[model samples]
Target: MVWAFHTDEPEFCPQCGDSLETQSTEDGPRPHCANCRTTAYHNSGVMARTAVVDTDRVLLIERGAAGDVGAWATPGGYIDAGEPPREAAVRELEEETGLEAAPEALTPVNVGFLEFDGGESDVAVNYAVLRSETAGTVEAGSDAADARWWTRDALRADLPAEKNNLRAIGMETLLDLLDDRS
Candidate 1:
């Protein structure tokens, strides 16, 4: 299925100073530059989420800003251009939680559609990571306000009530994956 996450409205054409017209494409209706006949396609962003666990506890981060502020989520972010999802997972894990992990070490768990505010949607690629070696070094960094280990009970108790937010990043699915692995 087509993932609808972000939208862009181009009033004028970048190539020319003409107004953009609406045109339907395979993906969806997009803005078309009349002067240059260029269509501006807004594609969905891809995010990498990892369920990093240490023994019986899973690592969660409290978001500092943007969507889901103060809500707990797996350490993840948008995948950079030209970077693989696994590599992005590793990079985001380190950036958000200060946990060093290898790309090959992350195990693919699930793929789900996440819808955010502003009509943005993302294809969330979830993974299960169990690298106990770096568990002790995890500290909140980057976009995270705080990072901590939580038992399943604590996690279930503390997550936000918004089911859409939780499903967007496959938080519940990740928790289930952690349980299955354990």
Candidate 2:
């Protein structure tokens, strides 16, 4: 997706708005706003995620509502204001999957950037990794329709074709980590 900066119009200076023009720079294209003499861009929202892997199977939550409904995704959600991402990740894991997790058990896995709807407002940062066995019984609530553990093959077969914000744990990465534990 194209990442463009923006700024408010002259009359609406100081308020957030689209940029008027794009100027090329060494870094890349940036929006230049004479009104505030600053650059404008939408900072990707930070989301906390946890990949709960048990044995050779990984847990996936089926979304029940908007923003990728019926798609299998990792346990996570947007970090609330003033809350740390790690804490948010753990909280979301438990709330959505009914799995209590310690903050340290969740290792940083990968960060993916995805743009949707023609970049109207497409930006997200996903922080995740394999979680410890401390995670409790699986529960389905909030925006999840169901929760289940799937093998790599099962996941590939079950995943929907159209998934916008779906975040699935990498099978190879999980397998490597599990092998290390063994």
Candidate 3:
């Protein structure tokens, strides 16, 4: 489930320091400002993507950013404002890994919350399966250093060099979700 933090207080908006009306009760506090037509807290929506693979191995890419740098992750990113989750998944997969993938369906996988320095983070929704009639070559692009497929055991065993703390979450959850399908 997604959580939202809304407030009308000037603190919420960097541009406008307008006074925000606060509603307080047993449910806690919520801020709404009519003039700004904004809430104090923003709701970060779900980011969905597919875990594409070749043979028994799954694909992963090294992140280019200092955050999670050198960390291995499936080629995926945030769902766009209007686009569907599946489309976003395919687009991200192609952009990051340079491999075209057609996602079959949403295979639910659990992703834990990640806390990063500088307060930047996202809620990730990952899928277990996607297919490609022709497996094209992979080249790293965008925010990726390298792209390659690794067997499940191999991927799990070499976790130290992979910077992302969520790698284990992604691998284990994808495996469990795929098991449900079979």
What are the root-mean-square deviations of the candidates from the true structure over C-alphas?
3.6, 5.4, 4.7
lDDT of 3 by residue, 74-177 (tens): 77777777787777877887788787756554454565454444444567776655444325678898888887776667766775654644453455675554
Best by TM-score: 1
Tens digits of per-residue lDDT, candidate 2, 74-174, equal: 77877777888788988888888888877767677766555555343322334444545465788887888888887766765766567423533444554
Supply candidate 2's per-residue lDDT for 85. 74
In terms of lDDT, model 3 sits at 0.62
In the predicted model 1, the residue pairs found to clash are 5-120, 5-121
Error of 1 at 151 (Å): 0.5
In model 2, where is the ten-residue run with the lowest total lDDT?
4-13
* CA shift of 106, model 2, Å: 1.0
Best by lDDT: 1
Per-candidate TM-scores read: 0.83, 0.67, 0.69
Q: How close is candidate 2 to the true structure, as a TM-score?
A: 0.67
Model 2 Cα shift for residue 35 (angstroms):
14
TM-score ranking of the models: 1, 3, 2
After superposition, candidate 1 runs with Cα above 4 Å error: 1-5, 14-18, 24-28, 133-136, 160-165, 169-172
